[model samples]
Each structure stands twice: as C-alpha cells, then as structure tokens.
Target chain A: MSNTLEISNLSKNYGDFQLKDVSFTLPTGYIMGLIGPNGAGKTTVIKTIMNLVMKDKGEVQLFGKDHRDFEIEAKKRIGFVYDTPNYYEHLSLKRLKNVIAPFYDRWDENIFMDLVGRFEIPLNKPLKKFSKGMAMKSSIALALSHHAEFIVMDEPTSGLDPVVRREMLDFLRNLMEDEKKSILFSSHITTDIEQVADYITFMHKGKVVFSKTKDAVREQYALVKGGNELINEATKQHFVAVRTGAYGFEGLTDDVSQTKKILSNSAIYEKATLEDIMFFNNIKTKAEG
Target chain B: MVQLILKDFRVHALLVVICLAALFAASTLYIALVLLSGNGFKTELMLYTLITILSSSAVSLLFFIQDEMFKTDAVFVSLPVSRKQLVWSKYISSIVLLLLAFTAHFFGFQLGVVINNGVGFEGAVVYEGPLLWCMLLLAVVAFKSYAFPLYFKFGMATGGMVFSVFQLLVVIAFLYSLQFETWTDQINAVVVWAEQRSLGGLFGMLLCLVVLLTSGSMPLSAQLFKNKNLGT
Candidate 1:
C-alpha cells in the first residue's frame, strides 16, 4: 500500500530548540501515533508538514506528492487540526462554518451539519462560549467535512477528561472504518496513543527514536524486575534505562532476548506499555546528558 | 481569495457596522462645523480627509486586533490557500474596507449638506471635489503599504506600535515644515504646477504612486508571511 505521508530528513532550528533530521512515514489506512515527552518536537513535525512552520531542510510527501511543489493540492486532501483550535471565537459555529466551508472543494454541508448535531455542538452560540470538548468536536467536524483523506492532529487528547478522550479516540477509530483514511496523531499522552494507534513513532530531544508498528514495538520492548543482586555495571548496558530500589531493580530493554541473555533468566519480564517505554527512554536520555 | 476576504467581513460584520456608524457621526458633525464656520472650505476639505483616513486606519487596525485574538493567521495558513493568497486577501479586504469607509463618509457628508441646505447655509462647500478622493487614497495606500510589511514581519501589536511612532514623526515633520515659509512655498509650487497640468494629471500621478507602492508591498508581505512562525 502507498504511504499517506512520508517525511524524511526534516530539520528546523529555533536557536534554543531544534528538530534534527526527523523522519517518519504513515501508510494509508493506519493510525500512527507520534508520542514523546513534552518539548520533543512532535507539534513541530506536524506544523512543518502542514507548512505552518517552514522547514529548514526536508522532503515531505503527502498523498504521494511533494508537499512543497503541490502544496495547495496536497492541502486540499489534508485535514489539519491544531492542538488549540484557532478559529474566530466571536462568530457563532454556523457563521464560522459559512466562512470556512467555501475554501474546500469537497466540503459536505450535510456531513458537517450531521457531525454538529451528533457532537451536540451549538450552532448559534459563539465559539468562545464553547467548552474545550465542544470546541475540539467542532474542529474535528470541520476537518472531516472536507472529505479529507488524511488527517494530521496535534495533541488532540491533551487536557481532556478520560471519558471525553476515550470518546474522541473511539470516534477516530470509527473514522478509520473507511479503510482509506489515515491519521498521524501527535500526543504526549501515551495511553491515548496506545489505545488508538496501529503504528507508533517515538521521538525524543528533536530526534526520532523509532518508527514501527505498535505490535512490533510491543514485542521488542520489555520491562524487567529483579533482585538488586542480579544487576551490575556490565548488565546495565543491556537495559535502555534502569531504576534501582533498596531491595530490587526494574529496567526497560528494547531487546527482550538480549536482556534475558544478560540477566540469565533471573528477572521477571513484563510487556512494556508505551508509558514505560517513554519514561525509561527519558530517564536514560537525561542520565546520559 | 474571495472566501478569505469574505471570512474577514463576516467575522467582523458587527465591528464594521459600528465603525461606519461612528464615521457617519463624525462626518456629520465635522460638516456642520465647516458650514457653521462659514468659509474655510480648504481647511474643511483637509480636516475631512484626515477624518476619513484615520477612520479607515482605525477600522483596519481593529480588524487586525481581532485577527490576532483568534490566531487567524495560523488558521488561514493551515487552509488550502497559499501564503501569497493570504497576503493578497488582506490587501484586497483593506481596499474594500477603505472604499466602504469612503462611501459611508460620502453619504454622511451628503446628509450634512442636505441638512445645511435646510438651515439656509448657502456658502458651505457642497462638494469637496476629486482632491479629497486623491488625498484619501494616497494616505491609506501609503500607510497600509508601509504598515503591512511591518505587521507581517513583526506581528500586529509590535508593528502597530512602530507604525504609530512613524505617524507621530510624520505629524511632527508636517508641523515643523509649517513653521518654514520655504517648505510651504515648495509644496504650494508643486500643487500649482500640478494644477497647471490639470487635476486629472495629478490624480493619475497619485494613483500610479498608489499602484507602485501596493505592488511592491504585496510581494514583501507575502514573503514575510511565508516564513512567519504563526504560533511562535
């Protein structure tokens, strides 16, 4: 299957912060979660792809076309939702819809109206009066109304309550039932990503750590708990990160079999959640720096 | 481009109405004072020109402030429209607004003239003529051309502060020039020369200047906007 979005060697410098040769791909009909700790440049990647932030050097292919050369055409097929909805808040939802609807060639008024009704967004109230959840729903409705083939959302689940976040994730899953739509969802919330992403791209400190299928990541990474006697400076090299307690030690390793070889089957191995992977990686990175 | 232009109008429809109403009120009051003062028609025209220009600037600035509040720049850039289209939309919308403000002033001034006629004020200048139009267009185009680049480069609040300082400097220079007879004579000389060549020639020259400034301003604004980090 063709890739929905392909970014290679993306770089952007903001003096104190930078995105360093970031690269990733999302195949059509899959949800790729871009997960990292805060300030990891996930939002920057999304912004660069949408051309909201100009890349210093890179190639971005969206819908199999160079993003820069066919920017208008590429964007026509993209549904971009910002972390914070940046709509004119003084206008009512209906008025805002009227203003934005004409710009998209495939905008479906019926779909928009239906989403508004289903999401229970008020058509007559100004967006400033909307709750955060309502505002997000409105943004999603607008993004989807254009019959967009690929949607790039930046931190959509942040600041949301668990129930609302779950519903939003469920809605995204339902959207994927079409088998042609793809999503590149950026979020710091690992649980949210774990819940909905078919693939995961982990990033840290302006660099992409790994981009692979979620099942592969799950199978490859593991958490090990064992007595302190089983740990040493040599064995520590096997774990990406290790935390020691008074009586025991817990560690994260990307290669379960290699870690087992180092530990000699003494440690209890458990599946590493996305949170565990992110936390351990962060700890290791901070320790190294 | 039309959608982007219409977006601004629809979003700021209330503000536009309020500005036009205020402009009408100001125009009506100024026209009455000019008629009551009984024959400073030249001064009246100048004052009216200043009022319309200031009103247009104020309206556009208010619209920009609204845009900043909503982070509309970020939203627009994310749309299918190019940065060039976004900049052109602003220029077009500003021109449309300038024309709207001019129309509002025209109707208001005409209303004042009708009222003055009823009050038996025969000596009042009935029509300010094409000079007013030329001055109004020149002031707005020049100001917007200079200001838009600053705004696109440095954002609305900072650019506005700088633009205000520039306006203050221009006012100071104008006042300082008034104290010098030679400067006044040179200006008068130019005006006399232009009128000698016919007012149409002068109007055409001002319009050409407007076109040139606007043409140069647009690409600069577009280029600035293209690299602008919106949320940054």
Candidate 2:
C-alpha cells in the first residue's frame, strides 16, 4: 500500500487565523494521530484534505492523485467524522441510512445494519434524541459502512465517557489490522492518540512542530532533571526548554543519550511520553522569543 | 442524486405540507369571496391559479435559500455525492414540488369555480395563468442570479438577505416596466392573445417553463456549488 494521503505546503487564511505551510502524510495500513493544541488548525487541515474548504496554496494528493482532480471518485473512498455528529436532528437512523446509502457506490446495507446492531443505536429514534456516545457511534457506523479506504476523524473521542472511549479506540485498533486501510485521527487528547496511533504528528500555532513514528518520538525526546546549580546557561542551551524552580530544574532534550553523556554527573534522564513531549515542545516554542 | 433529492424531501416535507395547505385554503377562500360578492367565479379562479403558481415558485426558491445558506452545509457536502449532484437534486426537487403545488391549487380553484358559478364565466379573459408562468420563469432566473450566488459567497444569513433584496428588486422592476407605454402595449397584446387562444397560451407557458428550468438551473447550480465552501 502507498501513502493514503499526502498534503504538501497546504495553506489557508482567514483574517486573523492562518494555516501556514502545513504538511503531513498518512501511509496506508497505519494510524496517524494528528495531535495538536486547541486552535492549532487540525480541523482546517482535515477540511482541506476533504476539499470542504478551499486551499490558498499547495497540493493534496490522495491515492497518488491530486485531490482536486480526483475529488468525486476519491471522496467515495474517504470518510469523515467530526467532533459533533452533523446529521439532521429530526432524521431517524433508518431514514438517514435510506437517504445516504444510495449516494455511495460501495455502500453495504448489511454492514450498516450490523454496525447499527453492534453499536446498539436505535433505528427509530431521532438523532436529536441520541446521547453523545450514540451519535458518535452512528457516525462511525456510517463512515465504516461505505467501505472507505481512508478514515479522517476530527476529535472522535473527545467528549465520550471512559468506557465509550475505550470502545471507540478498540474499534479503531481493530480497523487498523486491514493493510489496505488508513486513518488520520485528530485529537487534543494525548492518551487517546497514545493508545491507537502508530505515528504521531504534533501541530501547534498552524505549523507542524514534529511528525514521526510513535517509537521514534518516544526514543528521541526525553525528560531531563537537574539541580538548581546545574541549571546554568550552558546546560539550558543544550536542552529544548528548562522549567526552573528554587530547588531544581527539569527540561526536554531531543538527544537524551548525548545530553546525559555531556552532563554525566549533573542530571537525570527519563523516557518521554507523548504528553511530556507535547508540553515541552509547546513551552520551548513559546520560550524561543 | 436521487438519494439527495429524497433526503431534501424528508427535511422539507413539513414545510411543503404547510405551503400546500395554505395554497388550497387561500384559493378556496378567494373563490368563495368572489361567489358571495356576486363576481363571476371563473374569472376569480383564473386569478387564483395565477397567484398559486407564482407564490409556489417564490416559496420554493425561498426554501432553497433557507436550506442551502442558513445552516452548516456539512450535511450535504460530507455525503459521498458531489456538490453538483446535491445542487441539482435541490433544483430538481424544488421545481417538481412547486409544479405539483401549483397544479393542485389550480384544480381546487377550478372545482370551486364550477360549483359556485356553473361555468358561466368559463370563457372570461384569463391573463393570470400566462402571467403566473412568466413570474415562475422569472423566479428561477432570480434564484440563479441572486440566491445561488449569495449561498456560494456568504453562506446563509448574508445570502438570504441578498435574495430578499433581489426579490424586492424583481417586483419593483415589474411595476416600473408597467409604466412604459411600449411595455404596457406589448403586455396587453400578449394578454389579449392569451385570452383569444387559451390553449396556445398554455402551451407557450409550458415551453417557457421547460426552457427556464433547463437553462437557468443546471449550469448555474453546478458552477455555484462546485466552488462553494462546504465547511460552513
């Protein structure tokens, strides 16, 4: 399988908000989590890929074809789920299926029905009456039933309860077993991405701070703790960002091994989790000025 | 495309029902008033049919403006279908529904006329039918030029306001045009021609409707929706 999606130098601008030179790729057979802070342009990036919003510059290629050129057919293979369910409030599940099933060439009624049963969504109840988890489940069911090759979800598990979130994550994990399928799931929740993402892309202030495999991210960035006396200009220059206090200081560094070797008798290093990396990166980026 | 049409119908079913009921009630009341006032029922039926056709067309355009422009367009654009399919489906459905509403109202008006006046004034001049057809054609053109563009450019609120302004302009244009001596003469001649040969006038109106619907909606809808910002 090839790259399911390739977005290069994609940019869009609203008076005060701008997404500048944003680029990323999601390879087939893997899940790429787009982890970002609030207002980091994650939704804008997803919308651009779907052509829901116009691009001011750059290109998006899905399945090795330019998005604009293959929009009609390419869209058939792409399914989108937003943070909130976007169905008509008054429509029942059955009515929605009836309305949507005929639009997709690959729509499978049996698969849809099975999903409905599995999710335990009521067919007769209006979407407005559904709970948040149920609505998200229905959205997932619709997205999967179309046999889409690439699934793009913007914050699919943001507001769900622990059990429902676990269920959603488990379903996504199961989905990743198919080598032909790919997913770009965006979320601000580090734990959610940590569990299911094979690769992670960290975006901040409309720019990609980092994009790497989950293993590489965990291996490369590390948390460093040192005494107040060791937290000097020389030591600070070596680390990404130093959070200093009266007793000691802690910092994040890309080269934990090298930093430990240089500061052999000075600091202690520990493996970085996704959350630590994101926090320090944000702090480092903010402190640069 | 058919699925999109069906979905639109499902969403708009309540509004359609209310509009149909209103048309029927208004037409019947007008016919009753004409009979009670001792005015010829057939003449009044002709006017009622004309108003029904015009109002139905205008109302359908209004609904299109409301649905496409006002809310999050994600419901339509996020589907597996193309924008062209969605726009075309709305256009086709609106025209079909408007025509159905007009026909039903016309039939009800004719029935009421026959019951009240016994067809005594069946041959009275009926300018409203042809005039209504002209109005419907104008409504389609107005939708293409004003409402669809507003939807494409500004989303719902601004586009809806623009459409309302355009509708007002259209009415003003019609009233203003009536003041021109040549325009009045031509319109009077067309009305007289329509009265003399009612069947030919009806056929001409049908032809105009076909032309207007075919030429006005397809390309414009495709162009507008193709470039529209669906995220909003």
Candidate 3:
C-alpha cells in the first residue's frame, strides 16, 4: 500500500530545543500514533506539516505531493484539529461554518449538521460558551465534514476527561471503517495511542526513538525483571534503561532476544508497553547526558 | 479571498459596530467645534485629516487585535487558502473598512450641519470638494502603507509598539528641525510651492503617491508574511 504521509530528515531549531532529523511514515488505511512526552516536538512536527510553523529544513509529503509545494491541494485532502481549537470564540458554530465551508471544495453541509446534532453541539450559542468537550466535538465535526482523506490531530485528547476521550477514540475508530482514510494522532497519553494506533512512532527530546508497527514493538521490546546482580557493565548495554530496587531490578530492552540470550534464563521477560518504551528511552537519554 | 474578508467582518460584527459609532461621535464633535469656535478652513482641514487617518488605522488595528485574541491565524493557515491570498484579503478588508469609516464620518458631518442650521447657526462652512476627498484617500492609504508591513512581519502587539516609537521619533525630529533656519525655510518653501500648484496637479500627485505606496507595500507585506511562523 502507498504511504499516506512521509516525513524525512525533518529538522527545526527553536534555540532552546530542536527536532533533529526526524523521520516517519504512515501507510494508507492505518492509524499512526505519534506518542511523545510534553515538549518533545510532537506539536512542532504537526505544525511544520501544516506549514503553520515553517520548517528549517526537511521534506514532508502528503498523498504523494510535497506538502509545501502543493499546500492548498494537500490541505484539501487533510483535516486538522489543533490542540486548543483556534477559532473565533465569539461566533456560534453555525456562523463559523459559513466562514470555513466555502474554502473546501467537497464540504458536505448534511454531514456537518448530522455530526453537530449527534455531538449535541449548540448551533446558536457562541463557541466561548462551549465546554471543552463540546468545543472538541465541534472541531471534529468541522474536520470530518469536508470528506477529508487524512486527519491530523495534535494532542486532541489532552485536557479531556476519560469518558470524553474514550468517545473521541471511538469516533476515530468509526471513521476508519471506510478503509480509505488515515489518521496521524499525537498525544502524550500512551494508553490512548495503544488503544487506537496500528503503528506507533515514539519521540523523546525532539528525536524519533523508534517508528514501527505496534505488534513488532511489543514482540521486540521487553521489560526484564531479575536481581540487581544480574545487571553488570557488560549486560547494561543490552538494556535501553535499567531501574534498581533493594529487592530486585527491572530494565527495558529493545533487543529482547539478544538480552534473553545474554541473561541465559536468569531474568523473566514481560511485554513492554508504549509507556515503558518511552520511559526507558528517556532514562537512557538522561543517563547518557 | 472574498470569504476571508467577509469572515473578518462577520466574525467581529459587534466590534465593527462599536468602532463605527465611535467614529461617528468623534466626527460630530469635531464638526460642531469647527462651527461653534469659528475655526477657519485650515483648522477644519487639520481636524478632518486626523479623523480620516485615525479611522482607517483604528479599523485595521482592530482586525489584528481580534486575530491575535482568537489565534485565528492558525485556523486560516490550516485551510486550503494560500498565504498570499490571506495577505491580499487583509489588504482588501482594510480598504473596505476605510470606505466604511469615511461614510460614517460623512453622515455624521451632515447631521452636525443640519443641527447647526436648525439652531440658526450660519457659521458652519462645508468644504465639499475633490481636493478634500483626494486628501482623505491619500491619508488613509499612506497610513496603511506604513502600518501593514510592520503588522504583517512582527504581528500586531510588537509592530504597534515599534510604530508608536517611530511616530514619536518623527515628531521629535520635526520639532527639532524647526530650530534650524534652513529647515524652517525649506518647509515653508515646500508649503508655498504646494499652494502655488494647480489643484488638478496637486490632486494627481497625491493620487500617484498613494498608488505607489500601496502597490509597493502589498508585495513587501506578502513576502514577509509568506514564511512567517504562526505560533501561539
């Protein structure tokens, strides 16, 4: 299958932090979770893709077109949801729709109204009166109204209650039932990603730690538990990061097979979740510094 | 482009109404003062000139303030619209608002005149001529030429502060220049020359300058805004 999104050697500098040669790909018909800690350049990457924040250097392709060169055409096929929903808060949803609907060639008023009704968003009330969940639902309704083939959301689940977030995830899953659309969702909440993402791209400190299928990640990465004495200078290199307690030690390893071979059945291996991978990678980075 | 311009007007309808009302009030007060104080054509002209420039600038600045308040640049950028189109829309919207402000001031002036006539005040002098209209247009366009480039590049908050400082420096320089005999002589010579020129020639020159400044600033603002980062 062709890739829905491709980013290569993406770099941006903000003096205090920098995105260093970030690379990732999301195949068509699959949800790619861009999981990273706060301030880990996830939002910056999304903004750069949307050309909201101009990239210092690199290339981003959307549906086989250079994002910058064919911005209008590329954006026509993509729906964007900002973390804070950057809309005029003094206008009602109905008024806001008039301003936005004309810009998209394929906007469907019927679909928009349907979503609004289902989401229970008020058409007459100004958006400033909307609760956070209602505001997010409004954004989603707008994004989906134009028959967008690709959806890009930056921290859409942040600041949401668990029930609202679950509803959002369910809506996203329902959207993918078409088998022609793709989603790139960025979030610091790993469980949200774990529940919806087919592929996971993990970032730490503005760098891509890994980008792979979720099943591969689960199979290759493991949390090893054993005595503290089991970890030595030679064995430590096998672990992405190691944490020790008085009774025992647990470490995350990317190469589980090699680690198992080295430890020789001395340690028990457990499946590493996305959070575990991120946490261990962060520890490794901090230790290296 | 049209949609974006309309969006600005429709989204900020209340703010626009407030601004127009304020302009009308100011215009009425100025006209009443000109008639009651027996001010000459010169004083009336100066007061109207200030109103013309301020009205256009105030309207343009309000658009920027509203954009910043809502962080709507991000929304615009994400749409299918190009950056150049966005810039063009802003310029066009400012011109439209300039015309609207002029209309408000004109109606306000007429109301003042009617009220004065009702009170048996014959002191009111109306200067309804092509020269006045052309001068107003030049003032509005020239202020926009000065304001938009800075606003597009540095955004409203920072650009506004810089513009204020620049204006202060210009005023200080003008006052300082009056102390020198040569500068005062040159200024007087230019004014005398302008007065000596034919009305048609003066009007054509101001129109040419206005066109030149506007066209030049359009491309500069578009270029600066093209690569700008719309970060919160």
- Highest lDDT model number: 1
Residues B68-139, model 2: lDDT tens digits? 543535665766667777667766776677666665566556665666664334343342253544544444
Q: Model 3 off-target regions past 4 Å?
A: B37-45, B118-126, B129-131, B166-215
Each candidate's DockQ: 0.73, 0.46, 0.69
- Comparison by TM-score, 2 against 3, better one: 3
lDDT of 1 by residue, B16-59 (tens): 89998888877887787676667766545555655677777777
Provide fnat values for all models in the order shown: 0.82, 0.42, 0.88
Worst 10 residues of 3 chain B by lDDT: B119-128
Per-model TM-score versus the true fold: 0.92, 0.88, 0.90
Q: Second chain TM-score per prediction?
A: 0.80, 0.68, 0.74
Model 3 lDDT per residue over A109-151, tens place: 9999999998989999988898888889999998989999999
The reply for model 1, stretches above 4 Å from the true place, is B37-48, B118-127, B177-203
Alpha-carbon RMSD, each predicted model: 2.9, 3.6, 3.8
**Ten residues in a row with the worst lDDT in model 1 chain A?**
A82-91
